[model samples]
Target: MRQPQQERSRTTRRRLVDAAVECLAERGWNGTTVAVIAERAGVSRGAAQHHFPTREDLVAAAVEYLGEEQISELRARAAALPDGPSRAEPVAEMLLDLYTGPMFRAALHLWVAASTDENLRAVLVPLEARVGREAHRVAVELLGADEARPGVRETVQATLDLARGLGLANLLTDDTRRRRQITRQWARILEPAVATRTVRESA
Candidate 1:
């Protein structure tokens, strides 16, 4: 039926994106090509091109797709909260996931490539900005306490930045618990910073 055909098309497109993500993560950004994605997806280059006309098009979509996939996981983590202060635990946990998760690993790989490739930066910069802003928004929406502070955004973003750094450190050293502990400590400390800033702002 027409619906089945449409579903097949959608699945193929999703497969291409999944293939691209695996290729990028496993092979690194520069190592991945449209041909490689096609091969990984079990599709012809022409079929891949039909879905994504240019190399950059596929790269950008892969980045956005990976981000969306990760955010979905984060949303589920957020939703699992118990509807009270206890919810902050999962929020901190989600932040941990964004930093150390597979999707972030792929994203960081793309970022490393984008740093030197101006053309790639053109494709990736917007995505990075969106991800950063969205991460901050998620922290505020899900984790921020009452009497929200003016500098809460900074605290949350800083926590993310530190987690990212520590994540790479953990990647090289295979030290997951160390980085997780750092994030947990920062999450506890950030609340007071927010309260202090809120008091100052309210005065």
Candidate 2:
């Protein structure tokens, strides 16, 4: 009885979090009300309230849940890439895919909302920091970037920043062509740095 109850609780919470993400993506912060999220989740208002006592609490939990899901998906995608000298482009492409998708859009909505809402900022800042750190770790590991080498860490960070900027552009304009051009160009630059580090370490 206890086990089943716990499982059901988890299911309900998951549905609520997922519904919150969808709400955030479809409607901006002001539009994503607790009642709306409950409707989308197919749960009663009381149940939503029981799960999340306040709007801030619910949105914070939703962001954390989405961040975890994104990180897990990132790791899985990274693990699927073929290991070789030619892995950099595919890794970079995978990173771009992660940055340009629905989860990123949901996060962008939160970022814009948090700019004016102190409560939201208080919840988002630390969560964003954690997600950024984990993303950097995954990128460096999957791309076999040698941070011990001079400027390698900075290069990897810059690549991520560049990708994010491109993704932001994608939100407003059709930057797909430019994004591809820039990604390929950066991949060319990054591959050499990775190769130099490998040779130096092997020598």
| lDDT winner | 2
lDDT digits (tens) for residues 1-203 of candidate 2: 99999999999999999898889888978888889999999999999999999777787788788777877887887787666556777777777656676667778898999999998899889988987898888878877888888988998888788778877888866777877777787778888776454444545
Query: Per-model C-alpha lDDT, please?
Result: 0.71, 0.81
| Candidate 1: residue 120 lDDT (0-100) | 81
TM-score of 2: 0.90
lDDT of 1 by residue, 58-101 (tens): 87787787777676767776776655444545566567656665
TM-score for each predicted model, relative to the true structure: 0.85, 0.90
Model 2, position 160, has a per-residue lDDT of: 81
Measured over all alpha carbons after superposition, the RMSD of each candidate to the real structure, in angstroms, is 3.9, 2.2
Error of 1 at 167 (Å): 2.5
